[model samples]
Target: MRLALLSPLPPDPSRLAHHAAQFRRALNLGGIDVLTPLVGQRPLESLEAARAWVAERDWRGVDVVHAELAPGQRTVYWVLQALARLPHGPALTATVHAPPGLLGQPLHAPFAGVYHARWLPRLTRQASAWLAAPFTRHIDRRLARRLAGVLCTSDASATRLARRLGLPRERITVLPQGLPELACPPLPSGPLKLLCLSGPGQALRPLQDLVAALGQLVAQGGDDLPPWQLTLAGATAASCFEPPRHDPLTRLQADPRLKALGDRIAWQLDPDPQDLPALMAAHHLLVLPERPQPWGLGEAEPGPTAPQGACDLALAVGRPLLVAQQSGQAEQVTSGNGATYTVGDHATLLAVLQDLLTDPDRLSDWATQARRQATSRQWTQMSARYVGFFQQAVARSTRAATK
Candidate 1:
């Protein structure tokens, strides 16, 4: 059977795009023909063109027209929705790759009409975000319904999508994000090398708080303790230091906290996304110290969902996690795998670090378990599962059509 995938290739560096590419390769390797039109950077333009592309050939001959829905993938969603309404339309499915926090409790509902008016879009984006949210959801429900299963990357996400989008919980499949085939590096021999991955925007305040907590640890270090190094990536390096201690707002080239900690803090300036897996493997732990949840009350987003990419890489590379309790990223974590600390709680972070550093045995144990988790969710296995899910989706769709 043939599947036509509506998703992006590489160089875009989105989590959804990365997984789409992974599934394509795995399915092809497993003997399924995956066809994708040559859609480049301008996806909306390409999506509009796909109508003609399909009309010229056999769009109906395709078994499944699968699309992954991201903010960037909206145009493709519209196109697929339009296509599903045609006579003898092909079966279509979608993978909801958006984080649950954004989907579950949308801040966009407040900004409903603001999205369309170009000038208004710049003002109250809440209206626009609300307006843009349910693009073809109603149609998607009727067309694909049970047959066109909505794929979610996590169980928590699937649950949220069901509750928020009002879709059937049974119809949503939990297909976690896939990682590139990567080998878990050996455990650290020296100080704990902690890598802090910053979120999409200037979400570094929590990291700064953790650093300050570490500073407090250093100050209280009249007692001997194991040392740790923090390497941050994603956003520009900034200090969350207090006014008297350091500049509060500006990003200093050389943070004094680094000096206070004997220069242990470092950051990556927009590292290439392709290099991330290797970077994740290099570090011993991946920490996403995201802010608290229920975002959009005149503060940084609470990061309602887990830091999926960060958590995925850490698990894939066998590096244990040190995530915030507020993030959904901490969902599957256990005392055996890694630790979760409260956001901005430097003392908790300090205590967790002190315990891990002192007890290397526990640290090593967590890493081992992390690798096992990674092995279970390997791309090869995930792709096989996707193929199964697709077949099921097609049969359901075919049966529904017959009825």
Candidate 2:
């Protein structure tokens, strides 16, 4: 099949870009065209730019036109608009990385101005976001229905997106992130190394809760508790505008903790992608903090769901996971693979950590289970599923057009 994928490609430094690149490589179909949203170094900041880019492409002979989408992304919006305007074009489908809504950070290239500003401009951009937020969701939902299929990373995400888009659940496909090809190295011994992945403009509350839990562990240090360290790792996209004060790690360090645990936490912000496998293998457990509510000033206001990259990474490296109750990662924790704690309940997080650390045998067994699970979700397996899904989408689009 002739497939055309529109997404931010590698050297873009975003998780979305990485995933898209991996998927493209794994699919490895003949005659596949990889179109990027970036001009020079960053994503196209305006709808006009995205439209012109789409118009320049000769989409004819493409059996499928798939896009990788996220909130506040104007490129996806304009590309979908162009596709809808096609009287009879390639089957339109998209992998919606996040649900339809605004996020704590200006996820769109144009919204960066709001996040980088300290005062009036920030407020004005924020107000503009508030006004445009609903319309964004409206467009997302509308375009979603026009496509042959929608893809999500998790079942919870699929359910949420289905409801938000007012589309039937059957129309959406839950395709978990594929695991990278890597052997499960022996679990590292020494201070218990824990890893958590965060994104730019991520909510602060989850990290704060984790720090509070770690502080408690430090204050109540005893022979029963294991020596441990937590590493927070994330990549910032080129399109994201981050000032020193707005950086997640900087803000996290500034927050006052109950106990001053020096050197117990490490920051791995924007590590090279090639170094990720080694980094993951060096850690004993992966932690995914919970953000029950989406990122926004108003807790009541809904926002896009978080990505499931950490969970996928944990499986890729065969590390056991410890996630909060509300985390989407929790769904991946089954039987002996991992454990979960109540959302925002740092005490429970601490207790779970202590339980897992004290029992080395259980942790090892969980690591084995994680690797076992990863084997089943490897790209070799997922790529076949993706091909089947695309074929079905094309067939469905054909049937609909005939009607």
Candidate 3:
């Protein structure tokens, strides 16, 4: 079948773009005729072009128009709606990558929230007011009714969308994000080096906690402990670091414990994607300490759902990971493969690190288990599942239209 896969395409690092690329490849492999818009140099320009491009395509040959929608993009939503309303239009299916409910949940802790809160009030107020407003709500209702199917990223997300949109659970499907294939290398001998990969202005507080834990461990006469190092990549922007101008590498640079082991601990400002997997494979443990944010107002309580990309990647590499207990993806981690600790629990983190460093046999066991788990969760397999969901939606939409 000819499928016009409507999405913002790559070399953009946005998650949607990545997913679209993956989807395109999978559809082609499945022998589906796909038409993707040419994404230009700038995003807005490319989106406009894409809309116009899709409008001109022959709908008769297109069995379906699969659009991936991100929340809060009113223009794109309107464009897609217009396309779906076209006379003799193809079937419409939307994959909602980030919905209002998912977006409302804070992905990171204090510092990230502090930055978000600066601009979030106006945005949230506008969005909430718009949803409540009669005309806007009416329009949204019409759009929801017209949509053939909606796809959510997680079961939790699907449930949230069903309640918020008042749509039946049957109308929504859950499709989780997948990781790229990575080879699991044998565990390196000697010190168990730890690595952390994060984007600009992402969570750095967790790294600070790790540094503090390392210092505390050394102070407690754990100097004889096997060497451990941390390599940080992907925080170039100044806003990335928290105040005090002291990063983990900088703080421990001159210290005897880290200095004596020179080059053991290092930070790369930025690394290319191709090099990342190999870099990740070289490490013994991947550490991601994502702190959860409090939800709602007036005696707000900590809500679940911490970021999970790091943990996911670590698992994909088949490496033992140390993630914060509060992270959204912590459920995927297990003692058989890796372990989780409470946020800022330096004592626990230190003990875990020490144990891995001191006990070589246990470290080997963890590494093996981690690799086994990672193999089961490859992106290719995940993509095939997504394709299955898409096929089901297409069939359902066609049946509904015929009736």
Candidate 4:
């Protein structure tokens, strides 16, 4: 069926852009005609001009206009707002990525989830966001009601959307990230190659825990513990403005405990996003150190959720996961796939890692399980389900109109 997909064009640095790119790829695989609305010959210079153009568009021909949502993304916000005004427009649908917009923008507390703008001073923006947050949330609630369906990468995000928009659980669908089916590669020899893709935000730091765990492992077992490798990508602080950035790697590297375990854990500084799949495949398991419910200044905000890209990558590459128990990725890490631990608790993560790192057999089992999870959620399979959701929404709307 014909559809108009509203999302940032790819290479824009938001993981959601990459997600939209992947979804577009999946839609193509399913043989669906997709359209992306872009600038015209007149060259719209500002967001206002862009909104005006969108306001005047005739979109009735398409069956669905699938938009992507991240907390406080102005472009997506405007586009969705424009669509919202049209009662006769294509059926509305969206995929909401949990908090931390692609461009590394911080979303404030749940009720007031807005990003820090470069143009606006910090104090002024905070004041404006506080005032506008409720209004934006109101719009979001209305948008949810207008949508035929809402998609979230994790069930946690779905629940958050339901709460924020006051939509029924059924109105939001958990379409966890999907990857193409691939044969499970043979388990690699030697130490478990642990990988993490945590770009340093004060909010999460699995590497520190990894280092702590490493120290414990060495302290208890000396070299007797199972030999394992560690590779962390994007452990650097993402940004320091909204919330201060934390650099766990630099700290861990300095610790006498971590220095003792030299060269055991390798650090990948800003690895190319394009190489992520190959990277995942090369590793044994992916680690997520985020809390399930994100916090702001020690107080929890129930607004937007955290990112679950590691879950999708793990699924895609058949790598087991070591995710935080509270993080949304926890849902993807079943008993067989990986272990989960409370994010801030160092001992639990230490013990869990010790078990798998020491025993090759368990690691192999989890790898097999990871591949199974990936196999079950392949894009070829999921894309069909995704398309069907849109079709079903359109069909239902059409039926309601006839009645």
Candidate maximizing TM-score: 4
Give each model's clash number: 10, 0, 1, 6
lDDT of 2 by residue, 242-339 (tens): 43213455567566682266677787877775777788898998887855434333212221113355577778878888888667666788747888
Model 1 agreement with the true structure over 81-176: per-residue lDDT tens digits: 567656677677887655442222122233422443334423365545545557534444454443367787767778877776567788888866
- In model 2, which residue pairs have backbone atoms overlapping below 3 Å? none
Best by lDDT: 2
Q: Which regions in candidate 1 have their CA more than 4 angstroms from the true location? A: 10-16, 38-57, 99-121, 131-147, 219-221, 237-259, 270-275, 291-306, 332-336, 345-347
User: lDDT of candidate 1 vs native?
Assistant: 0.65
What's the candidate order when arranged by decreasing lDDT?
2, 4, 1, 3
Question: How do these models rank on TM-score, best leading?
Answer: 4, 1, 2, 3
Off by over 4 Å in 2: 10-14, 29-60, 71-73, 101-120, 196-205, 214-221, 225-241, 244-276, 290-308
Write the number of the candidate with greater TM-score, choosing between 2 and 3.
2
**Segments of candidate 4 deviating more than 4 angstroms:** 10-14, 39-55, 71-73, 99-124, 180-184, 202-206, 235-244, 292-307, 344-347, 400-403
- Residue 173 of candidate 2: its Cα lDDT? 90
List CA RMSD, all candidates: 5.9, 5.7, 7.5, 5.4
What are the per-residue Cα lDDT tens digits for candidate 4 across 105-197? 323343233234444454654565556656656656765777777877766767777777888888777776777566567666666788776
Candidate 3 residue-wise lDDT, 228-312, digit = tens: 7778665344433323222443433455654544565677654655566677788888777754332322112221112455566
- The predicted structure with the larger TM-score, 1 or 2, is 1
- Indicate whether candidate 1 or candidate 4 has the larger TM-score: 4
